[model samples]
Target: MIEFECIQCGTSLRVENRHAGRTAWCRRCKRPVLVPVNATPIADQPDEFPTPVPPAQPVARPYFEPSQPPALEEPQETAMPAPVKRGPIQAMDTDPRNAALLAEIERRGRVIAQLTAEVEALRQAAESRAREGDLLEAELAAARKMALSGVQDTGRERAMIEELNAIISTQRELLVEKDEKIYKLDAALRRATRYSAETDGNTELPDVPRTLEDQTEAGGYEEGAEGGDARANVELDEARRLAQHRSLEIRSLRNALDDMAAKFDRVTVELRNAVLKLTETQQDNERLVSELASARDRLREKEFEGERFSTEPAQAPAESMEPALLEESLSSPVQVEVRPEPVWATAPVPRPEPVRAYSPPVTTPASDMPAQPATDIQHDQRVLVDALLRFLGRR
Candidate 1:
């Protein structure tokens, strides 16, 4: 006999007949079973065969050789079945297990709903972040364009700074040269002033009578003759006084010129020093500006590196690891102190004293005589008077 077992539950089915082909059902589980023929027996039990039943007789039909016409039958229409009605949901007034399972299902449904909401929120956040990233990318592109423009500007500025420095250096050199020139000019002016003073003092002397006896003897003539001589003598004295006054005026002028020259020399020296100090100030300014530019460049580089690190996720480690140290290092302000150059007070150049114009009196024969001489003295006196008058007029 062939044995068959249920595949799902592993239950054996019993067969009543042992035939070539037999079909049966399992008694434990109400399912159909089929037995295979030519089966092996278990535990030495012989295979049993069932007795065959009699066959049913078939009725005989008359044979005809004629062609028949087929008749068409009317098609029957089947009624459509109604949809099945569902019963109302039962309330939770029954078993605790059912209530618990329903509650668990409801809880799981709520949890699923919450999870779905969280997923939607996360998706929205991701979308927002993507939009923000797009905006940031546009801004970054604009910033990069601006940065390139700034670099060009920086080059221009650097060139300008270099040009300015060159100009300042040239100016400083010119200032030094000017100072030297001023010093030389001052020395030359001082020497010229001293020479002028000496020349003015030694140039000429006034023509004055040498002896008082000449005046007394010339006064001893008759009233009418002495009157004319006395008038002439008075005129000569007035001429001498006028000449002395001129000499005094020339001495005053020389003194004034010397004083002016001395003042000019002192002024020139001061001006030269002022120019030098100004040049130094300009140089200092250039140096400070260069230092400031270097500091700013370093600051810009630091900012660029910081921005680059901030923008890239992979570079975030560098930002986080030493931000304080970097900030502390970068944020310190550079102090540049420019000390003012000292300006020394220049002393006044002393003017040389005015030189007096003096000359030794020369004795004449007429001025030395005690009595009048008789050798055409009137003609000689007339000649002398004419010469004196001419000299006074020329002066």
Candidate 2:
């Protein structure tokens, strides 16, 4: 880039290095002047006269702004003034002052022409800048207004996040309380098992032959252990019955506890995921709010700039403002891609197991007790499982 003073009015003008030794109009004086190969504009030097009066600028600018004007080459050096040819008497009659006056008139005319061209350039540039400023202001206003309307959406998002947080907290509390209850129930089950085992151990050995008829009569039934096999003991059969009942009860309780525990775990995991989603939604809302604020600020600043440009013509130069406006584009905030959080159904907790009353131990000798058939034991287990399944189905 190069900068130089216009000799006619002392207005500092700037140009690219390619414009050196070429003629361009002085923005202040409207006179043609030459740019130097290496020069600097003195910012402190004021123009000798006010800028030339501008004619109305071209209103129909193309969609794309035009490039910089071509430089005006030095016309004086290439086309030298022609020599006057006069006859001897006529030349003598011509006044010397008249010749000087004619030359002055020609110089003034060139100056007037240069001033007119410079004025036109300034006018065109000013109009373009004004139009661009108006467009920018419009864009900024529309963008800001759009973002402002989303304030309600942002508030709703925030409220939903808070609501989710509250729900998650309550669920966590319920889970903790339920876990405590489960722990207590487990401890009670263990104690019950130990008590049942101790009661079984304290029983005395039974005399099966003597007590067989008596025990069968006491129960109001006269069935043998294995349907008339003499070796099948009646006392042993009674003990096996009690053991089967206890085993079934224990199995049902354990299964129910396990199912409940698993459900709790699944519920906890789902609640945690919900919390994560809520946190993400909160972050998005915050970002959206920030964007809205910035857009509003930008709109206000642009509105001020537009007002100042429209009102003050002295500060806006046709040449300087054109390049600046060409580089600038209207800015607006882009909204983030937001989505609603989803709710999922979780696994259900099983109902509590029903408690069974403890049975009294039967008096029988372990060495002499008859072994129950595997098939009978399996059949009893299946019946217990079926009962428990039915109970669960109702719930």
What TM-score do all the candidates reach, one by one?
A: 0.27, 0.29
Q: Per-residue CA lDDT of candidate 2, range 111-226, in tens?
A: 34433343443334334334434543554455445445444545555565566556556655755665565566556555555555564465564444457777766454324322
lDDT of each: 0.45, 0.46
Clashes of each: 0, 0
Itemize residue pairs with steric clashes in candidate 2: none
Q: Pick the candidate with the highest TM-score.
A: 2
Model 1 lDDT per residue over 221-333, tens place: 33545465555555555555655565565566556556655655665565566555545544543443454344345434534543443333211112222445444433434
Candidate 2: list runs displaced more than 4 Å: 1-96, 142-154, 205-395
Question: Ten consecutive residues with minimal summed lDDT in candidate 2?
Answer: 343-352
